[model samples]
Target chain A: MSITQISVFVESRPGHLTRTLEAFAEAGIQVRGFCAGDTGEYGIVRFIVDRPDAAMALLAERGAAARTSEVLCARLDDRPGALARAMVACAQAGINIVYCYSLAATCIALSVKDIASAEAALADADIDLVDQAELARVLAGATL
Target chain B: MGTPMPAPDQIDFSALPIYLPEVECTSRERIRAIQLAKLIEQVGYTYARVPWYRDQMDALGVTPADIRTLDDVRKLPFTDKSALRETFPFGMFAVPMDEIVEMHASSGTTGKPIVVGYTAADMDVWSECIARLAQMAGVTAADRVQMAFGYGMFTGGFGLHYGIQRIGGMMIPAGAGNTERHIQMIEDYGTTTLIATPSYAMHICEVGEKLGFDWASSTLERGLFGGEPCPPRLKAEIEARMHITCTDNYGLTEVMGPGVSGECLAHRDQQHIAEDHFLWEVVDPATGEPVAEGEMGELVLTPLDKRGIPVLRYRTHDLTRVTTEPCACGRTLARMQKVRSRCDDMLIIRGTNVFPSQVEDVIGRIDELTPHYRIVVDNEGGLDRMTVEVEIKPEAFSDSFEEMSAFAREVAGKLRNVLLVTPVVRLVEPGGIERTLGKAKHVDDRRR
Candidate 1:
């Protein structure tokens, strides 16, 4: 089972975020990882939730354009150049990084180019990479 | 060889005093004759000074030597509004930027608006011409005049504002907005005459009647109106309701301002184009040749005395005709008929191009639209379809859509005869169309 992150388009307004949160609450969906960003007039809300399909339906009912994008989470060594080697490995395999976010002190998340070949490239590099099935099972098993 | 200079005929030239500048000479003959000499000198000066006019004059084989009289004025090429935009901001001004005292412009193209500068003397010319126009309307030093045109980069405001001061009349430069405040000022200041677009005057009158202000009872005696054309009926209604005589004033920012030509106290619908300071010629719009006497054509004016940005035979695009017939106002300036339409205002539906004025004339006379209407254009299957939306009072909206459709079709039929196109009528509930305080904008072209 692949875990897909849902990104919803929302107009910037007072109480818009609260109203959207209520929609998720009504559907009994717990948002595990969330990113909220404002682009002057509107916000892009991206959520990694327990049930992406049910959450997407709530957004679609409210006339919002929502989409799914593949994302990755990786744990790196605390030492410097540990992530640099991973980047170099991806570069050697002709993989480009679209976006990367700092997950924690020892964990970095990434949205990359070519999910399939890049997944093979990560496996070939002997790097410990968390796949979608593992992330979805962990999210489903979480006590929220 | 210098072509024989034709003497300016004895046409009534005072019909348009606003476009003219004050030369030292007073009479039209002296002014026209002075203009001729200046015309010769200007041809030489511009030919030497300005590069574009030189090229145009050069192409025509017209030199300073060829210009002898007002008749020789034809030797110079006619410039139009597009050329001013081509020149861009102050590129067209003959004088240096330092000499210009003020600048104004209409809406811009692409970015910042296209600008026009007035020399200190240009301001004086503008003001004096308007003052002369006010005097023609029986405005005096004792009379309090209320001006209701919008102020800003718009020319109508400052044009009339300065002219009232130049004419030495007590002027209340009440720029547009706040109709109630305008009425209050009229009452407090004992405003005798008013300057505004005719539709605004009608609106003010309507409001006053509702508020029980008795604007009709007030001493507000006369109105100088333009910006948008006021049909014969609305002109009559405003005059009667506001209890003031209404005079039509016409001009555009492209030429100068609203004081181009104004009706004098004689109540003549025709405005006398001031030929002495500005040479007026009517040309057949299609061929770009001078129309015969009594024939309707586009009015093109050449400023003889305008410095800084003097124009020669600038096409105004206003359709009009000249009659040598005498005006009772006693000014000998030629009488120009009411501007029928601008060449650009004509709209093409399917294949036939139509002007809003054709529908407007009939719409104004009918009690249906009550003077507020909109013209919306859309394209379908490569054909332009126009809908004339009428904002009749809600009481006028019959319960039946069939009756409404029939009513609209009747108006469409009337427009078909005049414009050769059938436009569907859309009967709007009262207050459906927005009332524009400035120019009444009706055309919405959504065609690809």
Candidate 2:
């Protein structure tokens, strides 16, 4: 069974995300990674957390609106055109990549039509496929 | 076993029956009269049990005896959502805790879920009223039913589910989403009735087409679309796709779920309320007086038969035009036109009240954009900042971001003239905005 990295949405308003993160803080659920962008009023703070269930409960108890879905944790080389090659391959594979945003400083998040095909193509091109276990380790305070 | 069958006269339905007929033997005017009488009974019942209600009624010099007829409704106090927030959770339940059977709540998208209860009798009344609704929508005992409403703390799924079973129909509790799965049951199990939100049913039709399933030509004959208003075009769209006569329904979770009012296929303009179980009042938004017949105003509701806890003169915040005229379908119960707009969803942008539905009406008329859009509200200095972000068709893109922004500004300019609200228009790419597994909420109200 493959565990999926979930982007728990946290609001950016005052005390909006405090209790949510506090739940994880108390549960000792370390965040592996996160990316947040704001439209002045609201922010979509997506995160890769180590404790998915605990994190869900923490946010849920606080009534924070969040969704846990099976998102692929794809890894690519931090080099020029590395992202392009993957996008081109996916496009060639008839997979439409809708809304590509940043997951981290190095990694980019793409909501592809076929995550499995995107991963397969990236692997075929010799890119490192970051599994959930690896992401958990990285998010669990492990050095890159 | 057949030889020992008793006569129909031996049947005992004084207890809870699968379907307790609402308002066939009892006339609607009689029901309203009974409702006024019940309102008095409820006030007295609450005065002894519910202190806040007693205090409020007492403060108005309005005792239970003061309420006698429907005209006396003005003497009774009005209740709003703010009062619910003040007394939330269980401040309103009339019966003691052990008597309550179930608890359902409002979405509380803004705040905490305002909880309401169902007594054993409440459970009975809700089902029987909805059973009458299903009968009106053409669902008979032989039909296999598929309900695609979201069930949880919310009430739509459970409300319709109980109604289907009450009408002696075979029920597949296909609680919303998983489109291909619902289609499989519709095909293999031969389900005929579909009860769900209009948008969700349309989504199902889209998926069935993509997956090569035949729900359109299948045995499905009746559809009950509710939770939100469906425009005439979308109503026609769903009907064509499902090959079923799509009927519109109206209700609020606060008003005890989905069977408040429903449109029969004969006409979509007016929906008859279950006046026997619930009382309907259309009050002018400003004056709070009853609107004359065929006039526009806000809808106020009072549950007549409810016992666990009930609201009296509860303002629904839904704006509509009402009429008591006889419909093509022979029911004399008062009917209301589908809501014009939610007063709360009205945006006061640049001195004009811009309703999302008005913008949606325009967008639905235009073929340029997708059905999804967001009104991102922020604080513009001391003023309210309004951003109408619309998704451009994937095939339609400007040469530059500035060009796209200019196009959006032109659209915004048109909207400003139409709605009298100047909005900062931002043209976004297709499919970046959020989508809910449930209700499609477009208004992002900032400043809490």
Candidate 3:
């Protein structure tokens, strides 16, 4: 199963990111993880939030070009090799991960070309596939 | 494409017919003699009937008698927009309002617009001049001319309408805008000649492409463009895209809208002036002295036959060089190079005249935006585009992206109401635009 991520289109300029973050802060929406990348003219800021529906509504009311997409979330053991084992399993299954980021010390969020295949590959390797409900619970106990 | 157009080299310009053989192809001495005689009569007529001209002549210690030779025209005081503004409405009109048959006005820098009134005879002269220019651009009585210029207080629409009528051509008074309808009419009505600004013509081409309409298959054979300067690159692009011959003409409301000078099909680079109707002079902008022949300078004009609002030595502020060398078309009239830039900071976007000060006025009214703004002009998709980047106040920056977008739209709406041209308005963070030390650079023109 996949979790939702919110993405925003912002101009690549000073204070634009600050303004986006300010919107999140004012709404009292806790951000689990975020990533920002730019292409000189404009930038995209993607966020993993606890309340995506509320975040989407807030962004829409603010006149932002914001949208939500599904991505896979996985929980691994606290041991260092746990992530390596999951990555080796996906590699052995020929699953291509588009991008991945650490949500917490033992949790990761990833987007892949074949989400279902990667989810099955991870699950068959005895890796835990986290859904929206499990994600909120795991993030609540994890420290940033 | 229905039929491929003949390459530029294959076209024989010298074979084109002259509309007014007697006047257009007359000897240089004959043209000057005609100009000299008319200049004297117009000077005396304006001096005797118009009080403003009398005062200006009296202050300069000159009379109609002083204008004996063409060289003596320099003694008369130069008239400019300030004089017109000072005498708003009918104050500068040589004839009474009862005799004034028509009136037109152009956008001014601020407040009231500069007005021009035309008597019936003045209308005849205007029509005749435009008729000659239209014929020079190869418009015949058989061609269907579609006039897309706005037919309101502006002079372009009516001026060309009467001119095309004078030629006995089919008139489709398809006034400005409605691009889709314009394209459909061209395909249905078989429009042969298009009259519009060059940018608008390019825009029409774009709309036609999106509609899956083949412009090359259409019957549009030629275009008469005015109201703004058409760069050579833009003209060539329009001709190639629409499969039509594009020609440019120059005029302003103060002097007499369009019909002053136009490009003959024989020579597309320079425009042949209607020398018999208006005396042309190129002078140093700073000193007001005539520049050497064929050298670029500010253009000063004196309408030899304008009876309603006769002006002497009107400073046009447009920069161009004039050449008396005979053209291949055999017309003896002096030809002027294309006007590329202006002495002032006025920006002509699409067909509308835009001044940076007007942008400043729009920005001044908006509380959420700072005074610091940059006006960037560039050509995109063969059309002129103006984007105004305004800095948002820090206090206003806290608003959501949706709010800022709406605020930008509001500013753009207000600007359109004032400028007559819509510009893309962008909201920038505080201090996003670069700061300059002296005389802040407000405009970045990349169109050239």
Winner by lDDT: 3
TM-score of chain A of each: 0.71, 0.72, 0.91
Error of 1 at A103 (Å): 88
lDDT of 3 at B212: 94
**Candidate 3 segments exceeding 4 Å error:** A1-144, B1-9, B345-448
TM-score of each: 0.57, 0.58, 0.60
Candidates sorted by lDDT, descending order? 3, 1, 2
DockQ computed for model 1 against the true two-chain complex using alpha carbons: 0.01
What CAPRI-style quality would you assign to candidate 1?
Answer: incorrect
What lDDT tens digits, residue by residue, belong to model 1 across residues B263-333? 66554568766555566888866667787877667888876566767777788888777876656556657
How would you encode candidate 2's per-residue C-alpha lDDT over B1-448 as one tens digit per residue? 0011122244232321223344533465776676777777766776678777778888999888877777787888888887777888888888888999999998898888888899999888888767866766667788898989877987878888888788899988888789889889888888888888888888988998898876546878767777777777787787777777677667776667777876643356667777766777877666688877765567888877677777777899997767766554555566778885776676666555567777776666556577778888888687888888776663454323344456667788777766677778765545546788655788997956
Query: Lowest lDDT 10-mer window, candidate 1 chain A?
Result: A101-110
Instruction: Compose the digit string of candidate 3's lDDT tens values, residues A21-100.
Output: 78888888878887776555445577888889998898767666666878888899988699899899899999887677
What C-alpha lDDT values do all the predictions have?
0.70, 0.70, 0.84
Fnat, model by model in order, equals: 0.00, 0.00, 0.00
